[model samples]
Target: MKYYLLALWMWSGIHLANAQQAAVKVLTRAQENRILVRWGVDQPLEWQRANNSGFILKRITIKRNDQLLASPEKKQLVRLPIKPEPVESWMNLVQQDHYAAIIAQAIYGESFEVEDTGEQSEVSRIVNMVDEMHQRHSFGLFAADMSFQGSIKAGWGYIDTEVVKGEEYIYQVAVANDASIASGAGIAGLNDFEPLPEVVDFMALPDDRKVMFSWGIIPYKGIYSSYMIERATDGRNFTAISKTPIVDINDKTGNASTAMYFADTLSNNDQKYQYRIYGISAFGERGAISKPISTQGVASVSTPPRIHDYEFKTDGSVLLFWEYPKDAEAEIQSFEVAVAAKDQGDYKIVGKQLTVSKREFSYSKLEASNYFKVYAVGENNQKIASQSVLVQPIDSVPPAIPQGFKGQIDSLGVVQLSWKANAESDLLGYRIIRGQDKDEDFIELYDKAYPQTHFTDTLSLKLSNKKVYYRIAAEDFRHNISDFSEVLIIDKPDVIPPSAPVFSNYELANSAVQLEWINSTSDDLNLTVIKRRKKEDVNWETIASFTDLTTVFWDRKVEKNQVYEYLVMARDEANLWSNPNNSQITIAVFDWSAVEVIKDLQALVDREKRVISLFWRSVAKGETIAKIEIYKNKKGEAPTLWKVIHAGQNALNDVDLDINTEYQYYFVPTLHSNTPAKAISLTVQY
Candidate 1:
């Protein structure tokens, strides 16, 4: 009796808990031959308000007789199908309904009507009598629950239930947790319906008088059947042009196939026509029309367009205007503009193609020399361009200022100015301007402009001690002169003294000295002065003065063994003197005695031939002795009858001497008026 009472108490407690209702929402809509059921899983079920795990939406199809069906089979059951996000955690909740578990049962072939609840807001949890159909005999009975033990956050969920069109569906939502199940949250239902799909991507192209039209067919729920092509001349109120529907051979099947196309031979030239397409459903319902595509229905012409006038505006742009050829045989479609650098050069299209109605165009960033023309295009193409208009763009921008200007004075007092040249192609020449004082006005030095990079100004003697300032300017053919170059100020043209002359060759004799030097290389050298001083003297004396061209000097007033020092200097026309650092000194000496005698001597004789041969050597390395003497002596007789020989002949033969009688000979090498040198003797017989 104790166990029985305990069981009775537990049953009472479960009964008391049945009054708690679940807070859920359910909605069902028709799609093709199926029903899509959606629900909210935001609130907890009343049975376990704080401990719910997951939710279940049940769909029921009722029969027309208002009879409630019992225990439907599993094959007759449906599930809520929904696609999930890319995250793996949401896959079970948002996956396709085809893979969804059969969480609800429904009767096949049931027909019913669904009514809207007058209550707009969702139904709140309510207390109700417990339905005994749901039972939890053991903990294992929780196997069919969602197994999602976590709390239900606010989110939406959906499922697709298969059903017949024109049939009604009744859907009910329920939820379960680890402990128990709850039902009767809300109700909603609807019948299945369908409409035609829309047509898209319609296009039209003209080729050889035949207009080809094409479109891509879009289907609603993969049920598009065919398409119809239409045309409108006035761009509105289109009518079908094809006799039969352009069928989609793939028909209602969701697979890629060739797009539908229709070609119509143009009937009238010179007309503008628009075309569109419509998609039809399998039920023969027509859908919305596609966007229109227009084209010109005209034959091709080969004539070129004509240009009227063109000019360069002050804003650095070229404005061009042209007209369609009046004599064109075909309808004008567009006008093309082309430009070239020269009259006979290759041309390139300027900008975008223009409609025949447009007669004016502007081009920017043009070159100084440009030729432009227009080509009138028929429906087909152009054969030749119109006559070109030559344009010489005027230049108003000045050249960059010249830099690196410099000025200097030469020995001649001529001011030379130079500067870097400006690189403008239109540059004519350069001008040299000068100012005598810093605050004075600069005046052009030459009447004509200088074509070279440098100029010279010959200064007058009267302009001595005047500080001259110079600047340069570049001019163009149109006199678009650049600003003045950097000022080159040449202070008073003080004559730069000539470079000092150097002594090249000199000679000194008894009381006489001769000097020679190269002339000064200075262009304005006036003259040269020679100064001299004796070694015993304390001061220098001006010995001579010569003109600028003189290069030699002679002095005769000099004492023997006297050391003399001399310096040469150069003077320019301005009375400025060159440096005298280059000086030379020499001593006067004279030789009064004869030169030394030749040293080596020898002689040879031939008696049978009555001739003597003599040979001698000289120690004088480069100096030549005056002569050599040969003396002959018969045996036992003093040597006499001396004969003279030139110094170069070192050997002589004494012939015709006493033959068979011995004779002696001797030789002496001599210098100018010198005593006889040491002798060598030889005795010989014929």
Candidate 2:
């Protein structure tokens, strides 16, 4: 019969042309007397062209007596081109071999095209014609694979009886008088022969009334194109179950499987049957048969056991009870009980070989927590288990108290606590309680128990408490509570900073600034820092720091006429600083020695000229005056420097003075010593 020729197209060790080219494929097998050769075209168009033109066979003897022949001998097997026999000749072979009939029909059929139903579009007609040509090519090649004699008659295969022992020959086949068409070649010799290996990994799975068989396919893909299965009841005499060779068609698609499978229905259950398999090569040769495997079908279990109840005795033992149908007792060989410490843990068989009549089992070795299941074994050793049931022994003793207690509180008032977990298998969880003091009542942190060994608690840092306490207790599944663990004491972090000191008063004496302030009211005050900076300065420089309760500071290092800003900040033991907004003050140092330098200043207003004449007396002692400056201001306005006067002149005329307005005039001197000089003023009206 015709096969699909699926995986057989990908023949191993065959040198094929490029995928873009019309490639021809060839395969060879060596026997004791002769070598067999087969050739085919991969493309449908090439296959049709080859059939119409027939083929020419050529042989070249490349080696003789295991030695290379320098001058090879070439010969043409037939003077005329080889073509398929006439349709009349195929009639005799078609009556005996269905594969021969398939080939004859594919080549010389009445209608070589698919009949168009109703869709007459050009694209549909083209697609149908291409599909029909591919179908013809595939069936013709697949039928040739079934019969060696038919393949030779179809001009696709040949046998070389002229091959000599220890002589290698290369054979080539191509369409007659057409060198452009693709050609195929193969190398074989009488000595190039080895026995094929048996089929590998043959397996059988028996079911109620059917048996599934499978074997490894990928490993033997190059050696065998198909397989044949046989079965027997007596294990000695075997009968072929497959009328034709079985080809793996599933491998034609993507993601091919590595194994091939077949299923056989049995006449009755519980009857032993032996099975074996054979590998068939592309050249119609069968390899060694597989070793026989025996199996018997078995009836499937209708229902599994059900666990109803369980009881815990006072002696620390557990008794489990289950139920099964009484009428199906004969189908059960025995029963087994499995147990595990946890629901999802690995379970082990606890009771083995239990009689079918027994519905209850007593387990003497019981754990604190256990999950149990019962399984019923069938006559064929098939086991069906029941749904698992949890059984915790009657636990009166609670778990051990949590150990290794430790805790810490951060500056943000977040507390973290951790301890060693309890070792009891039945422990449910832990409970944590917190208190601000040892004598105060503790409060539960969570409504339900915490499931982990670590816990976190957020406390209010605004409270007046300085210490916090934590304790943990472990509980079991039976609600048995353990004693509280050791108390964990953690001092609360100092988030409250000390209050700033206020500057009450300050005095300048002898060019020294004396500052007095009230100290911070916080009890944890560590130090007071005094920082000073000029009015135009960007950063402050710490002038002094005091750890004691000193509210007075003498800033003796002072400069005249330079404005200075001071900031007093109080710091606590936690290195937190107080706000400086209420404690900052600015002061300007006055030069007392320069105040008397410009004395006896006078101003005269001339109404007729609309001008004011000013004059000052210069002592010219202890310092030389580089220049003098005159200042003028109205009665309620700020003063402005009116004019600058030369050192020797020491007089200035202010013009355009406001009439009927009282004005003030001041005189200042710029000394060569760079000392600041105070201004002396006189009031005048025009």
- Among the numbered candidates, top lDDT falls to 2
Error of 2 at 236 (Å): 9.4
Each candidate: what lDDT? 0.56, 0.80
Candidate 1: regions farther than 4 A off = 1-301, 311-319, 329-332, 340-348, 362-368, 378-383, 393-400, 403-686
Worst 10 residues of 1 by lDDT: 1-10
lDDT of 2 by residue, 1-686 (tens): 22222122221223222346665677888998989998877667777788788888899899999898999999988788888888778878888876676667667775444334442334335435556676567656766666777788888889989889989998988888776677888899999887877986899988778888999898887688778889999999998775667766555434477999888889889789999999888787888999999997887666789999988777778889999999988877899999988788998999999999999999988777789999998855778889999887666998888899898878799888888888987778888998889889898897776889888899898886767888889988777889998788898888877888989899887789999999998888889999999999989999999999999999988898889999999998889899999999999886746545777778877888898887778876777788777777898899998778777776677786678999987777788876766667788887
RMSD of 2: 13.1
Candidate 2 similarity to native, TM-score: 0.59
Task: State in Å the error of residue 96, model 2.
Answer: 9.4
Clashes in model 2: which pairs? none
